[model samples]
Target: MALLLTANVAGRTNGRNVARLLQNQFPAGPRAFRVPGVDSLNHARGQPVSWLVTRTASISGQELFNNYGLKPNSELILGYGFSLPHNPDDTIVLKVGGIEGRWEIGRDAQGADGLWKVILSKFVEASDATYEDILDASGMLQEMLESLIEKLPEEDIAGNIEVRADVVEMFHHYLEGMSNLVAEKPPEARSQVKMPFFALW
Candidate 1:
């Protein structure tokens, strides 16, 4: 909050003793928090902190000012500790040959769901490998996704649930994306990418 209000209090001194007034309002704390200045880490929560906050309150939490409004469910849950039941910013990324292709799955904005034949054509166009090779590697990937999904139970497997249900939902979305990729991509040379995150085979 203080971070957002600093600019409002900067030049709008209004002829009053703004510095002293702000100091009285906020005094000091454990110096646990930081306020950005010309230098990133030079300022602390001492003077004008609450003044900054109060001034920005009028604009704070307003959608126009919150850049996080478009973040996907996965990022919000893991980074910000919050998520909507249905976020339209969600995406599924397909990492192939060290290249990543993001497949949007948002309600208002997603891909046209590529045709299997078109996808396979693209694969053939991009690489020199045979159709059989692509299928074998893709089969490996699909099985990997299926196995991970299967390992996670609908209900908690034991007294302790290690993964959140929402996280599982994101994975399901990823699996859906993979299913699309596998369905369309043509056979190719053996994949050189290691499967640590996606496999042991």
Candidate 2:
């Protein structure tokens, strides 16, 4: 009984110490990496897992971007085979006129998750296509987006769609956002949409 009580007390003490260490070492706001301490006491394991927890000078994403030349989510995914789901420095590219040119979607223009509406509005304003073409393309684009959304299930399941839950959820979010934008605008405004990624070609 005495030994059990002693063991229980030691466990509680160890738990408190771990909690304190975590709290002090990882508060929040952009913890990039950690440096481990010397493993001299035991090649097995012990306390003092790591040493210094360094923080960047400024938390400004743009500042860090300028200093580090950070790449956007799209670029990172294509180049590095990984993606930041909530990447603040993300951008999208939309091709125009089949092969004439492309528009690089930036934060200032679309501000993340504004993919569908922004593309339509910008295309209408710039393209030299006729009103009928614009309308047809826009409608077609909406249908395509809706089709993709339908294919992408809301939640992940066992062999349900073969897509990650988070990926499914992310597309569902943006696609729903686009649908809401379509519903929000009037027929005349929607008719003015010009480019629908594939419809133009």
TM-score of each: 0.33, 0.29
Candidate 1: the clashing residue pairs are 131-187, 134-187, 134-188
RMSD of each: 13.4, 15.6
lDDT per model vs. reference = 0.41, 0.41
Candidate 1, residues 118-137, lDDT tens digits: the string is 34444564356465545654
Off by over 4 Å in 1: 1-67, 96-109, 112-118, 122-157, 160-201
Give the Cα-based TM-score of candidate 1 against the true structure. Answer: 0.33
Candidate 1 has an lDDT of 0.41
Which one wins on lDDT?
1
How would you encode candidate 2's per-residue C-alpha lDDT over 99-191 as one tens digit per residue?
Answer: 344544444334323343444555554346566655654665556445544654343344645876655555544444333332332233344
Residue 32 displacement in candidate 2 (angstroms): 20
